[model samples]
Target: MPAPKISVIVPAFNHEAYVVDALNSVLGQSLGDLELIVIDDASRDGTWDAIQSIRDPRLRALRHEHNRGAHATLNEGLGLASGDFLAILNSDDAFHPERLARMVAALDSDARLAFSGVDFIDSDSQPAPGHERALDYASACARCAGQPPASWLLTSNLAITTSNFVFPRSLFQRIGGFSELRYTHDWEWALRASTDTPPLWLPEPLVRYRVHPSNTLAEDDVWRHIHENAYIQTLALGGSLDGLDAEGACTALLHNTSLPPLATLCFGIAARRLADDTALRALTRPGPDGWFLRQLAQATGLNDGVFRSARQLADQQSALGAQQCLIDERWATIQQMSGIIAERDAALQAQAELIEERAQAMAHMSAEIAHRDEAITAQGRLLEERFAAMEEMGREIHARDQIVSEQSAVIARLMATPWNRLRRFVTKLRH
Candidate 1:
């Protein structure tokens, strides 16, 4: 019964869709001398079933009867892990094939380096945009080359997330494992661990971190994360900040403006707790602190003139943003009104064209009616002339008939007269 070279811890909750892929990535690693420890934190989904389906001897699956948080699950896995080195793989995230091999090699080569670099991937298991390559660990370290390890870590968590961390198991015992936190446990652990031994930077994308809607570091949890970060900073600093060399630490932190706002605020809190007025002044003297930092300052009773100035600046920025929003709305309304006016103009133009067409049609119809009226008048005159000619013919016919009747009567009278006897006597004598 020998311990594996590496112990991979997976804190799965509701990652049934991706848990298989995550498990496969770990079990299929090129370096086979590793044990996979998956703790199901009472997932309501089929994540537990998926974990059980994997039939590997090196795989150790644990289940919580109740829904324990991720931190508890991790702590349990750490306690049960039987390996020389430790690695964490979120159930929703996966690793490249060579991730375990590469990270182990990096840790083996350097005793002081706690972990290697990481790469981000999207939900589709593809490399995230702007994260095509592994993080520029060398450049980051080079930026803090001469600074103390504590100062560098206080400024930034060189290893971005737990998924990117693969350290010697002994280091966990030295640092007392992860703290009990709802959020920011990984960050807190990194802050503490890196302060002791700086992490080694492996400039290759070994892990595939999945970013999706269900990610724990969602925007809505920002405040919670900030609160936890401040708490962790306080714990790290203990009751006093004397050991941190507040002046030097503040200078180092301020030099890197790229540090997250939360980390900077944490430094401010530490300085305020220590009553290092000079450090506090230096930290907040950069014109204006952001709204969150200002709130932190006020909470810690560090609201001096510097804080007031920052509050005023924040108020001004907020007012400007409101004014800009109003301007945009007004501009949009004007554009909409302009569009409406243009549509009305077009409609009016169409109506005008229609009116013109109707007028032309009416004019043509009137001309046609006039032409028809003239034709009717000419026909009426022709009918009157024809009637007059017929009347004249009728009169002529009547006169002729009267004349014939009179002529017939006269012929009859003459025949009955004496001519008849005289003519007849003469004719007989001649015959």
Candidate 2:
């Protein structure tokens, strides 16, 4: 089979929940004439299972028995690419369906463009928050008419990720693959590749960049990232100035980032060792001491070490002042919180008093109800006794009526007899 148009390299790790969607995003892209190579970097989770579950003819699955870092894995994937164009998709991130198409068209249009990049989405697959300042900075640089792409990139990184990169395989061969910096590798690569011309910066978001606890930026090696950024800053603004106008780039960088003096910004890379190469180089004549910085330290009756010590002391004093300000703010907050607590306690006390009053009223009502209940019970007993007496009287009346009826019947029978009739006639003649 002929080689695909693009070779998409995915360096996978422990992202079980997200790996499948990432692969699906690649396979389901609008531009389908691309090959996808996923190298599982010895993930402990079910990320391999998720990657394996994808059934596609364009996919080539690979696995690492031991976990190599991201840069190494990417280089390995790069070696296996057969396509003219190359793209990288981080395991936890997804792609816009039309990303490859848009990027390819831009690259085909301009040969001088280092790569093609677009805006990105966050973990929710929407425009990320808290990036307004960075976005504004990049947008402002891009809007500067007649400026070279390198000048636009001198202030801040435009295309933020290797995941955002879509360039020719030949460019990858020239500038090489990712560096060892876990946090700022993408930024370093962005600066290195864009030294001549700017990448195609499409303002529209075409990729989902995942930001979570597991990101390389969230790693514990903060000093390493700082050192890496120091080197990267050196590449852009350090000794050689990386083919940029030194005065203009330095002013813009300082204005944009509010960074320290040129010497400190270039040399004071916060790596673990204080006497590292970069720091020592700052003491050289051409670095911080040459141009505007003469033997002013000796003029002030202090050597270079003493001058450095004085600067350190001043920095400590400033830090202490900041700490004091924070403490004062916290004390004010504590006072405000105390006031709120006092009001809450007062309200609770009022509620307690109201509850006590209600309890007393309820007790009084209960007693009154008991008293009424007792009275009603007594009246009920009296009515029951009266009813019993009336029933006895009715029985006696009934016996008397029966006796009178019997007596009347006997008298009527005597008057109806013949002897009674003759006696009545003799009594009438005598009268």
Q: Please tell me which predicted candidate would have the highest lDDT against the true structure.
A: 1
Cα lDDT, model 2, residue 7: 93
- Those runs of model 1 whose alpha carbons end farther than 4 Å from true positions after fitting are 109-113, 130-152, 232-431
Candidate 1, lDDT over the whole model: 0.71
lDDT at 96 for candidate 2?
88
| C-alpha TM-score for every candidate | 0.58, 0.59
Clashing pairs in 2: none
Worst 10 residues of 2 by lDDT: 303-312
Candidate 1, residue 255: Cα displacement in angstroms equals 7.3
Q: Which 10 consecutive positions of candidate 1 have the poorest summed lDDT?
A: 303-312
Q: Write the per-residue lDDT of candidate 1 for residues 1-431, one digit (tens) a residue.
A: 99999999999999999999999999999999999999999999999999999999989998998997887888889888989988998998888898888888878845443555555677788767464223433445555667655665554556656777788888887776676666667867776666545557665767777778787766564444444554544434432233358787666554432333444456645665666533333332233554445566677787332322222446667999999999999999999999999999999999999999999999999999999999999999999999999999899988988998899889777767798767878898999
